[model samples]
Target chain A: MPRWVRHRYASLVVLAVVIALLPLLFPSSYYYRVAALVWVSALAAIGLNILMGKAGQVSLGHAGFFGIGAYAVAIGPTHLGVPPLASLLIGAVLSAALAYLVGRPILRLKGHYLAIATLGLGVLVALVITTEIRWTGGPDGMPVKKLVVFGWRASGADTWYWITAGMLLIGTWLALNLDDTPTGRAFRALHDSEIAARVAGVHVDRFKLQAFVIAAVYASLAGSALALMNGFVNPDQAGFLHSVEMVTMVVLGGLGSVIGSIVGAAVLIMLPQALTVFQEYEHLLLGFLIIVSMIFMRDGIVPMLAKLPGRRA
Target chain B: MSKQSHFKTLFAAAAIALPASMMSFAGTASAQQTVKIGSVLSVTGPASFLGEPEDKTLRMYVDKINAAGGVAGKKLELVIYDDGGDANKARTFATRLVEDDKVVAMVGGSTTGTTMAMIPVFEEAQVPFISLAGAIEVVDPVRKYVFKTPHTDKMACEKIFENLKQRKFTKIAMISGTDGFGASMRAQCVKVAPTYDVQIVAEETYGPRDSDMTAQLTKIKAVPGIQAVVNPGFGQGPAIVTRNYAQLGMSSTPLYQSHGVASKSFIELAGPAAEGVRLPAAALLVGDKLPDNDPQKKVVLDYKKTFEATANQPVSTFGGHAYDGLNILVEAMQRANGADPKKVRDEIEKTKGFVGTGGIVNMSPTDHLGLDLSAFRMLEVKGGDWALLPPGT
Candidate 1:
């Protein structure tokens, strides 16, 4: 606990500062642009980590929540008379509430079953968005309203970077803080052994539902951020491939760690772009990398690296 | 450790802060050179078949224009991001292009779904953009900035029905993808059915990724009065539609597909089933078949030869849209005589007679999408090639 104490808010503050300054360092605006993308994708992965890493549950359809968050933010304000900020909060509440109701039933399922159920949920959301052209703008998607705060519009990338960075720091702090809380202990206990945690008097189902709701809220917020930043929302955010990408980012970085989710999101988002040719070779490289990671670095890159040289395991 | 003491120490001491160190080199660059235009295409995702070639065509046109003393005496710096069929990614890149890179204008988004997500960003920034996708919704609820180059599903459907009207194929069955393209095409078909007196005996949809269309085909075949089948714009939907038609022994029943099937690639993919398959297209692909004086003849031949030589891949309608889109954008830039986005957009709207590989694009203030029914030329596959359908059947 003392060891973790040194890196808590300080590390988050540093991360926040870095996000704010990253655009300045870029040779061109393109790098800052990709960096901002890293923040959005990282936000999404962090949401999923609550379910996969902390909650002792799995979800493949979290993107559905993300998409809902995005669409609601864009459409809610433009046509529904809700302001952009209000729509963003509404999206989070709706996604979290829906996650609570759905998680109560499906959280009982294990492994692949849980994943597939979530997958089905995401597909259903995407299908509805694409099919309901009148309300949701169909597959073509709805135009997003500009996100205005206090009667003033966000000036440019430099200004918005601060807002996103602030949210990311807050999100990270909350997740890390929760890890040290009693509910967090119960969730971790459930992750280690469900039966053992049950015998130890942990309310397994409630904890799972709580984590699911929390993660769904994170995803919804991430979606809102994307919609607000870009001023657009489309059904493709809810598509199955998007769901897969979130998982891939988590798994690629270091699934069980909060830092891993951020790192994973950063790496996963930047890598494919760095390896643009990797598009044709993505399935092959991704498969090989996953297999190798699972076989060798079972605990993921962060933990595995933590175990190496001068570090305590 | 005291919380305040720990925070002070941690904030004071930098422990291998790569992100912060990376951020230390921030510098703003101001330049006066060429106008930059950015685009996001689904170049590597499920829709790569559409995105990849479109990206290629865009690069080709930019190169061609820049080589020819550039547009408005200023070369175009074309920037692109491959969304790989992901909407969120498209949104991200659109913002980057418009905000960070400070592109004067934006053009060439792929898939109606992806392009739809970008409309708000373009509208918010007041960046003029031209989407190459065929969805009517891209232009619908029309944001002043979002424009399109390809004909909408409604126009394509009407043109197809008109061609069928001439062919005297009245009773038809419909096969479609469960995705947006399929749904849009189906809506157009239903709306136009009454005008053509065409009775659609049955309508079937297959999952977007479904490898087989046996069930849908079997149902379509069972329709007693079905004389032909109309397949909407599908990536692999035509192969399934044609294969299942052949399997059901309804090969004699004339099959018409959306312009999506007009490319030579479809013929190769569908094999013998592609023969006699008709679709409306702007490109007169079979050069020898068209008269020498045809406007598109020279453009088509040059592109076909250039693309085959460079990419070693057969051409597609996706490429045609890319060609038309870039040519128009460049023309607009030339007409604007500067990199001003609003000026470029207005000039684009006022464009009258510009020849593209596909057709003559004539943009007007009221219609950002200029190609009407007359712009479409009906083509059918014969011996694994696009054969222009003779006028009046």
Candidate 2:
């Protein structure tokens, strides 16, 4: 068996085991809701990791796609009377198309310039969502219709846990598999040096655009899952801070590790919940903890831990 | 090869450790004798100004209640989670409040967004939740288990328009912030304006973060026969608008701010420009100024005194909303004689003549928020302080 394929299957099995087993320790259904959030966030981070980690691209406005996905489900079900599940797909497709249209020009920029451009894109999306009160419900947000399939309602936290966890597994599997594919190699080549990849006959622009599109789909799917699970969608879901949060998860988890992305999501999501015991000092402690973790794990928690002695690749 | 196995171990250890820690905190054995009331407030984010006082008020009152021999023979245990003004987190915390804390009743949701996000969770859980938000949609469509303490923006608009009608100011201009509160109140005002014999002659909006709104004010000033200018916004935006109105010498056309800026800090921020500015606010803002014959005077004064002394800060209407919500829930619990959610919900629906910090609340089966326009007092800024305006003025 090829090493990459073996590693991919092994990672999937481990993740599946974790997802299946975590519920055993949950004292109540509340953890399921939180776990579902982590899964959705991790899926988005994994997508961002592909762009930031593998392709050496940074997107500060990825939440724009997320918002698009979220609002699509919200508007589609409320306005167009489409099924919630169908709207999720429609959102993904719309996000992919929008990414493609925007990525061609925006991907030409590099570094801070690209970051600023992407930031502007995210702000514009949030602005539209906030201003278009007729459809988007403005800043106060709109309720999402519960997901129903064949008369079965997908409404509780436990059900959403399984749904989001299942999606995250598929997302991680696809991302890990793509890591060693020809297209994935082209992305990595471009990451190493865009000039070198171009001289080596790699389709740099095409690969960059592909990565962007795929990442947008991931964010869109994640956003749809979140909105459906929460049963509400607001403009904040597509705001700049959310975009920064997706990037933070990617960077804090480890730039190139799939498991790292999941861990990062878990840490960021769970830490705030756990820190609620601090009451008014919650944000202060959260900021302090993040700074402490970053200092110890400069390369991110997963990579830093994996590089410790006695670990074998 | 070994790296994968190591990661699996790490993942397992981390997952187990995290939840185990959470369980240790949440799994205390005192669940039987205590009436658990859960809250999810935006206690540490953009809406913290609303949530911080709310958090303080709830804790102070819960402690006081427990000290005074508890409610229905059960000690009150408050379980609060701060959502940082994020809707997603609010939903998650609402689930935790229901399933984990097993709270029979809840009394927090600082912002409209957080309150809306949490509604489905509490509804599904069948727990009675008293929200502290100001959006009209919360109670307009009336869900079974949901109630709110704050006056709706629609009511605020109606009260302001009622005042405007008395002043015979039919032609008005609106300069509102584009934020949630401002936009919502503006829409509500526009919808109900004609009923009050008021017409919005000119409309302008400023972004939430804009330091200056002179442009919008200038446009509003340009409108012909504008009898009054209404600003439906909170925070520094309204203050800037107030200062800008004064700067542009548009004070000849009376400036009416919304309940969104009914606090004393607004007067401090806008300085002398806030003079003669009128808004509809809860009785809590003018506790000292309320008439002795008023039913809300005693309740409002007590809440203001206790909250300010304990929190060591000036009381805000936002905090008063929390006070009203918790007291209303406790009153219902007392009448029902227990903390059973169904019984408490029914009792809350039947609440009558219960004076709170906001006003005299009389909830009913059809009206979740039973306070009418009379609950809001028209107040004007006089000498950098809130001065109650008499009814029909």
Candidate 3:
């Protein structure tokens, strides 16, 4: 194994120890709820980073797939009589299919055009969810059936915290391992220069499409977890703001680092909770924090921390 | 002093001050014996107009209750969070309020969607939640721990249909926004129209973001025997519709707005176009016009005075919903003789003949809202202000 892979394995061990010890510090179940939220968001952010940092593509509307995943859990059981666990798989499959269909054409576009295409796609999903009042319950949102395994119901903030943490760890491991694969190298080459990558005999379009579909699956799974945990789903989950939030999580954490994506999710999710202490100035202070962080730590929280004394890549 | 010395001095001060403050706070909390009540409102987002006053009303009433020697001899501690009209934030805060803050009851959620999102949390936790949102579904198929103060969309439609029946307007036309609020009310209106012998001759829907409703209004105008035009929606959409109605020379056909537009801001937004437009609203909007025999008159007048003075703004029905919700919860807690969640929930359900700014609330095991179609009054915009239209007019 390479030296960097050895280092990553060490870091993963540390991460697992930290995750195991976090419950000891929780003052109440509310902390567990916050922890669960971080894990769910981290899962989505890692998926986004795969496309953005690795393949060098942007999706301003991952919330579209996220919403699809959420509604699948909500609508599948009541409408289609599918179990909640089965519906989660159904949501992921549906999101992957949608991504495959749309990614073929939209992935050809670069930068802002790709972003706009995804944004439009996300908006269209939100509109359908909002207007199809019969199926999706419109803007008032709909209740999601709880996840039940056999006779035992899946509940409690602690249960969700562990579940999401496990998923996030798996997602991060996959992303990290992908870094050494031929497809992963192709993605980086395309990200740096599509023409140069094409000359090197890499299947640029096929790799981009694969990255998009994988990211969509990641977002979809995260959305299913969120819906199942919250016991409800709304159109806002698919709206532009949520899409923007997902993008911000990937960028703010460090576009290229798996661990950075997780940290980014933690910071964004926990910052608002912490700012509650500021009361009426919460929004103002939150805006200031984002602005200052971007200015001082331009490469993101992970990259900046890695640059500290005696740190290794 | 040098920068390093100054930083050390500040840190030293904080270290000393924090423990001293903490000791005092713990002592006060132990001695006073307070009851914590949580609220989540959209205090700074699109629904701020609703949540801002609701927050003020909760603070004002909690202070008043404490000043009046507390409820059941325990001081009230209010824990409020601004969800900013976001469902995820509302759910997060709702859970925090229940688990971390250990609030006995909750009393706010400015919008229908936000309130709906928090319902399951309150249910699972077995905490009493008296919502201020104006959606029927918040109470219908009622969750055991959930109740609301605002009149529902179905009640609003029934009240309007009753007035139309009295006015002998058998045929009406409706143009509603395609948003959730509009869609819900439009469905309710259509469902209840036949009961009042009111036929909706023309029905059209406009997109939520549409600036112009001229096309929809034109279609409504061409429909023969359309006596009245009703726009059941919230936000600038209804104001735009009213302006377009006037522009199309359809002012001769009476225009009706749903309770969704029951605020002075709506009149201000519509300007002259809102003149003579009718709506079904809580008595608080026209308290002075209510007869002395009316039970709601005193409650409405008192809330208007106290809220306007405290909030430094005119009173609105949305604020009245918060006032009613908080007061009802307090009364229930007092009746239960303690802050035990299950006992308070039972007492709230048993609430009867409770006079509030919104209406005379009579809660039961089945009816969580406690108000009916009669809670609303037929109010018309006379000049630039609300004027109560007499019964049978």
True contacts kept of each: 0.35, 0.35, 0.28
Error of 1 at B68 (Å): 4.1
Q: For residues A1-313, what per-residue lDDT tens digits would candidate 3 score against the true structure?
A: 2334235344455456557877776667887898889889989999999999899999999999999999999999988899998999999999999999999999999888999999999999899999999899988899998899989888888999999989988897898788788989999999999999999999999999999999999999999999999988998899899999998888887778777787788778877887787889999999998889899989876666555422332
Best candidate (score: DockQ): 2
Badly placed stretches (over 4 Å) of model 3 are: A1-5, A310-313, B1-32
Q: Across residues B1-393, which tens digit of lDDT does each residue of candidate 1 receive?
A: 245444433433232235434432432353568778888898886789889888888887788778988887788888887887877667667866776668888877888877877776687678899898887877765667777888788888898888778878888888887677887888878888989888887888776778888888887777797777888967877787787777778888888888766666677778898888888887646655668888878887887777767778887777778877877888787778887888888887887877776577787766778776866888888887788888898
DockQ (Cα-based) for each candidate = 0.35, 0.47, 0.21
For model 2, state the Cα shift of residue A198 in Å: 1.2
Q: Is the docking of candidate 3 incorrect, acceptable, medium or high quality?
A: incorrect
Q: For each candidate, give its TM-score against the true structure.
A: 0.87, 0.96, 0.94
**Candidate 2 residues B299-365, lDDT tens each?**
9888889988998999999999999899999989999999999999999999999888888888988
By DockQ, highest first, what's the ranking? 2, 1, 3
Alpha-carbon shift of residue A122 in model 2 (angstroms)? 0.8
Interface RMSD of each: 6.0, 3.7, 11.2
Write out the backbone clash pairs for model 1.
Answer: A24-B26, A25-B25, A25-B26
Q: How big is the positional error of residue A85 in model 1, measured in Å on the Cα after superposition? A: 4.9
Candidates 1 and 2: which is better by TM-score? 2
lDDT, model 3, position B176: 90
